[model samples]
Target: MTTTAAPEARPAERRTAPAAPPPVRRRRRRGDALGRTGPSKYLAHAGVWLYVLLLAAPLYYLVISAFKRNTDIFNQPFSPFTPLTFDNFGLAFSQASLGTAMLNSVYVTLGAELVTLLLAIPASYALARSKGAVGRMVERVFALGFLIPGFAALVPTVLLSISLGLFHTREFLILFLPASALPLTVILLTQAMRAVPAELEESAVLDGAGPLRVLWSVYVPLSVPTLTVVAILNFLSFWNEYFFSLVIIGPDAALRTAQVALPTLSIANAAQYGVLAAGIIITLVPAYLVYAVFADKMESAVLAGALKG
Candidate 1:
């Protein structure tokens, strides 16, 4: 301290060193050469719209024709629009027993979905949690059912129904349709259930929850989106089912479903385009209503199913 005083600090030296330069963010402006859409993007958009138009064209025709007479439909086959008439609907409902058929379809589709969910949820949960020889075999069997066409089961199902005195009845279809839909439901739900974290179940168990309680409280909540998907899919298939209804509930106006009943209108009308169009619209309503209500949830379920944690 006695030798010399320290040199006085310079103003530049006293200032803090400039803070490290902020991270450089290179933001590309829109409409820049690299930001412009590619030819492939346009082509993909074109293809998608084309496919949509192709599908929508038939539906447009169906609606327009539904209000037109058979003569008008055939005579003006390319007519893009027409005066609206509801007589065709009356004709369809009256002659086809379509009213009753609609009710029957509601019963079958709802009953089948309910039964499938009840059976599939528990079965899928068990299968997803198990990893033994028996589980593998059972899973394989369910997978095999997916590959086995419904046509193959038709005869056996009818035979069983006849034997058990359950044929030609809604009760028979309620049971049989669910059984037919079960394997696919189980497969979808089993995969979805696997997506639920095991830790949730363990935590529930520590809270003194039993297996069933844990399932209802934990895994079930997590798996709800996928379950809605299963219900919607099964509802669509069961509602549109034709062959099974045609054969199983055949010729029975009281028990027939919409698909089965609609054809009778065709046979009677020489397949009147107008009346059949009305019938088609009637047949599509339930499925469309379901999709409209659950479309967002269904899309979420699909995305969730595609990704695994």
Candidate 2:
């Protein structure tokens, strides 16, 4: 009887409440200040646009000035699209010997790039693959060459050219240009070559291939994209080379490169902005064309190199 009475007792003991859930904490948003875009992000974007505009302004001026008469350029320097004229380009081509200078630039650039690649590839490969003290020493020496300004070498280079009777000669220009450009080329190509997998070389060798054979069959083929980048860089350097061309070739106006000729055309006492702009446009074309042709491959190669590193 007492047990039956106890069973009916106390509602407090009969039921229990379910547990409450833990509070949900929200994640903080990145690049946001008080749930809005940060000022730094806006500033960064603005700065990028500003930099782009800064870069484009000069090119815009050059194009506008190229089309304009001298008076228009002076009066309204910022105007977009002036009355177009082939006259400046024509004068640049004919009187300035810009056509010949362009041809000379092309010839010298091509020759120098070819020679630079020919020498740089093997040297880079050896430096990349070797592990000995001699290889380390050689690499160190090559790197040091970058420290010496090109101008510092000019006096000795000219003296040596004169002794070799190479002054004012195209052959001399070709040889000297490549020599001057080699250090940079080697540095770039070696860095690229080092990114290549050692397994590739090992596999080639295991297949009974020699070093040269492996280089030709495996390394060179894989490294084409890198080589293209190096070639482009070397071509640009040789194309824009001025001081050496100015001094070594020395007022042999006919032998001057496009770079050398451009400044020469500027009637220093009185600037011919139109003619100068045309020459600049002409010089820009080749580099632009080369980049356009190999842009995808070059980008891929550069990305790959970065990722490998």
Candidate 3:
């Protein structure tokens, strides 16, 4: 009777023991989860920083090389930290034809972005709002473009341009470049337009606004971030474009884009690495400047997309 009574009392005491607080239990759980994972937070951050350094090294070299002489660059390749000079820049501007190329690039890229947005906005809105068979078929066809590489269509596009008597012309490039934007622009705009509430569109219609008015007033304002993103993307693509520009507008010095002009720098001024560097940097400036000016818009676009996602 004494042994059985003692065992019963021990069990009761164990059941009454105080458990850990909620916060303590949560902390323990999180720690256990992290332990099961591969790396700690500090180790992960260290790896990321290391990757960034590796990526940035080439950009640093390019910038520094732009200020040094070719001899200095080849002899002391790693000594880009030395004092800077502007002679390479002067040479680059004079020999690289950057002045002419930059103006042409600006015109081409701006026109491309404008035309792309105009075409994409209407198409995307239609696809997003309509659920008809034609709309679905059109959407699938547009999506198919993504699987096809630009290079694959080069010969066909060139042939088509020649047939239309529009080959090797700025008009041809402006029209051609915008077409490339169609697939991505349509996809992005459809997603963005779909996110806008249908009730808002109906309300705008009830308020005595026409379709055009509603698009400009209601949809445009709501879709600004997405539009900005698409415009920026198309702008960069047109600006950096090399192949189409080369093939379409070849031997036409007046129509050569910035990227097309870059290779000519090395060819014309053989062994002048510094001039080549400066020309490359010159090509990059306009894009960077545009990005900097629209930096706020970029941040907002990213944040809005994140929240929507």
Candidate 4:
């Protein structure tokens, strides 16, 4: 008892909790340095908004015009957002024979895309896997297809169609579109296929896969993104192809594509801006739909291709 009371226990040292290591101010990365400044950030936002407005302007006009009367379209061109009517769409559908025309467009577009892929895939695979200078030379030859102006080839195409006795037939479009699309399609696919590892092909071959099997099993699956990109591009090009469809398919309402049929709406009602706009909008839907379905894939494909390049 005497020992316990011998000395007054010193007051226990008061512990101060460590100040939370100064709320970690993470060092800004060099890539993000430009985004930190207020002025630069605001300027970037302003530029983006300006660009968006520029792009949206025409679309806004198209949509507004589609619902307005011709007089309204002209007089109040960019005013009053009321008094909308769906009459123009009816006029467009009836006058343009849009129902049949859209069907024709769909048929031709899908057919052309299929034919293009059938030819382009094999050609691309060959070129991609070729080791000799001959492949490079052939690819350069294919590139020359771009040099031949589309307008310049129109005459030949017309004559070729006539010579084959396939003039004014949808079948001819199936044949022709693939020819036109082949150069770009083959080039893109070749590049994409080249990006596929040689090991995959070798493994495929060891598994008793032939060239065609290897292409189908190895290359095609890996190149889906690029294939999608090519498909979308070709679809749009073939869809909006007014000049070719008009010339090749002829003005026959039974055969002409939507693009060709759309102008007929204008002919029937020269001053009906709404009808014309409606027809254009109708023609645009399929393209928009295709893009919407595949937009994300398209973006990734483009980024991948760019990085590979």
By lDDT, the best candidate is 4
RMSDs, each prediction? 14.4, 16.7, 12.8, 14.5
lDDT of 1 by residue, 1-309 (tens): 312222222222323223333234233333342345777777767798899999999988888899887778888876856555899999989998899999998998888888888899899989989989999899889877766677878898899889989888888888888877777788888988998888888888999999899789987888886788778777777898888888888878888888888878778888578988898898888878877897655554444434321
Give the lowest summed-lDDT range of ten residues in model 1: 2-11
What is the C-alpha lDDT profile of model 3 across 179-237, one tens digit per residue? 87788778878878888899999998999999888778887788787888878767777
In model 4, the worst 10-residue window by lDDT is 8-17
TM-scores of the candidates in the order shown: 0.78, 0.76, 0.79, 0.79
Which portions of model 3 miss their true places by more than 4 Å?
1-53, 294-309
lDDT of 3 at 4: 40
lDDT (10s digit) by residue, model 2, range 1-309 = 434444433232322111223233233333343446566677877898899999999888988888878777888789765666778777777766888888888888888778887888899989988889999899888877767677888888889889999888666778888776677677777777888898988988999999899878977888776687667666767888888888887666678888888876677415679878877788788878877887654554344333421
Reference-based lDDT, residue 156, model 1: 88
- Whole-structure CA lDDT of model 1: 0.79
By summed lDDT, the worst window of 10 consecutive residues in model 2 runs over 10-19
Can you list the residue pairs that collide in candidate 4? none
In order, the Cα lDDT scores of the candidates are 0.79, 0.75, 0.79, 0.82
lDDT of 4 by residue, 1-309 (tens): 434432322111111112234223234333354675777787887898899999999888889999998888988988757688899999899987999999999999999999999999999999999989999999998877766667677878988999999999988998898887788788889988999998888988999999889988899999897898888878888888878788888999899989899888878887778998899999999988987887655554444434422
Clash pairs of candidate 2? none
TM-score of candidate 1 versus the correct structure, residues matched by position: 0.78
Model 3: lDDT equals 0.79
